[model samples]
Target: MRMMDRRTKIWILVLVVFCALCAGAFLILRGIGGDGTVAVISVDGEELDRIDLSRVKESYDIEIDTGYGRNVVHVEPGAISVTEADCPDKICVAMGRLQGSGIPIICMPHHLIIAIEGDGIDG
Candidate 1:
């Protein structure tokens, strides 16, 4: 019984240390940034439009007619998203908005990608 209790305590201490290391690693790796608040829209691997979301004083809708299909993008003060799409899956529309610099809004069928470009290190 004494040996079993000691083994359990050792395992618990190891687990705690491992968890702490993982948490610290996550915080460090999550500090990556993009260049600014500009949204770069691309279709079929070609640059289509670049909209600066920060300078967008009024909300507007941009209708994109790609060779594959059509996608309606909505631009707000600080965000951009595909509000409507003709793709069968409609996954791009369901993505809602682009708020972070991690993943870009992708339309697989239309081969369209909307990525947020960071202006500087602070963005």
Candidate 2:
């Protein structure tokens, strides 16, 4: 066993504090996501459709058929997700639903993308 010197202890404390601060900043930024009500669907860098999830009263399914493949996007109130995908991996379908502006659902084989964006934050 070895005892840490005073300088090593101070440096360790500094590192711990810095890490704590970084974690705090990350949490704050993550919590302050965009207004997350409008979902934008795109295929191969081309905009296809935009749906306001906030105004959705009943859930609906949107089928996106590209030349590459197909994906079924399920839309619910305040959220959207890919319920089915023809891609081999089917990762998009496994992503469930997007709650905020964290990540976009993507189907690489189909070149389909569904991203949530902020319309405006209401006070």
Against the unseen true structure, what C-alpha lDDT does each candidate score? 0.84, 0.82
- Candidate 2, 1-123: lDDT as tens digits: 699999999999999999999999877755565757788898987889999888999999988898899889889988999998889999999878887765678888898888877544221
TM-score of each: 0.70, 0.70
Model 2 CA deviation exceeding 4 Å by range: 1-33, 119-123
TM-score of 1: 0.70
Q: How far out, in Å, is residue 32 in model 2?
A: 6.8
Q: Which residue ranges in model 1 land beyond 4 Å of their true spot?
A: 1-31, 119-123
Model 2, CA-based lDDT: 0.82
Candidate 1 Cα RMSD after full superposition onto the native fold (Å): 5.4
- Evaluated at residue 55, the lDDT of candidate 1 is 92
lDDT of 1 by residue, 18-111 (tens): 9999989776544454535788899976889989888999999999999999999999998999999999999999988986564679999999
Angstrom error of the Cα, residue 71, model 1: value is 0.2
